[model samples]
Target: MAEYKMTTPLTDEDVEKLKIGDIVYLSGTIYTARDAAHKRLVDLINEGKELPFDLKGSVIYFVGPTPPKPGEPIGSAGPTTSYRMDSYSPILIKHGQKGMIGKGKRSEEVKEACKKYKAVYFGATGGAGALIAKRIKKAEVIAYPELGPEAIRKLEVEDFPVTVVNDCYGGDLYEEGRKKWAKA
Candidate 1:
């Protein structure tokens, strides 16, 4: 419905302003994590241990990138199916995480958490890993290196394209779009 250009470490105000179906180009630091990394992060949280990165106002991208070739900050980097992180997302949102970047549907709990916490869920173009990789300006493994591609990485991205799939106001583009098309 609208377009926005946002930077990472997104504040509550930044996320609250977004609406489902709005296009977004994100530029700033985002952390990468997939299933394994998410589990570890949640485990750490439960143990009251220090996390590798600060969660406050942060955006997490659900991706496990391919190994880079020479002179590239990252390789094919695409969003993974978001549901895999559903079990852990609400907890992260509660900890001050303001945004999530991934693809596909999320659970009810995750959606409620977004609304309750003033966070948003963004959907990256699936199957566009190579194109998305180009937007990443820098990447460094921040934790769980043994997991290889699944390792948590800190990434600096520039104008990385995405769309708002869910917003703080309880909007869900996937559901809304489906209903719209179903009625047509």
Candidate 2:
């Protein structure tokens, strides 16, 4: 249950020290990619094609934000359910993706990938899109503009908040909380 202030392109050392239930205030860059974009990314990797963004030390947020209002960088940027990306996640992690931001439980395979690759799974507060958008200082669709909201966008964030749902050492906050309350 520690709170840390971290910057992205997070290193393996940075992710390894985090434990499930720890809170993180992340600053710096992150990229957005939903299920549609994820499939494309995996396909590129399998083909040995170059990706749009460097996967090394990158964090991907599972979100497709609404169009920004006047003078705003983004709008209603909320996390999508994580399971939809489960199939592509381990592949990305193996390629150097260090963290993810989304809601809901991750698949066991995702957990195993995090453990094997020294990555982490983070959960953002769902239904808090507008609030989350405030943390995003800039956003630009870097690829697949045809995918609309599902496009890969490079984002600059300051103090973006998240919780460690799954840690590299095999800790899972969701399962731990369930067991704790079950015993109470």
Choose the strongest candidate by lDDT.
2
Per-residue lDDT of candidate 1, residues 84-142 (tens digit): 99999999999989999999999999999998989999999999999999999999998
> Candidate 2, residues 26-109: lDDT per residue as tens digits?
999999999999999999999999999999999999999998889888889999999999999999999999999999999999
lDDT against the true structure, per candidate, is 0.94, 0.96
Q: For model 1, where is the 10-residue window of minimal lDDT?
A: 175-184
Candidate 1 global lDDT: 0.94
- Model 1 residue 58 CA deviation in Å: 0.6
The per-candidate count of clashes, in order, stands at: 0, 0
TM-score of 2: 0.98
> Candidate 1 — which pairs collide?
none
**Model 2 spans with C-alpha error above 4 angstroms:** none
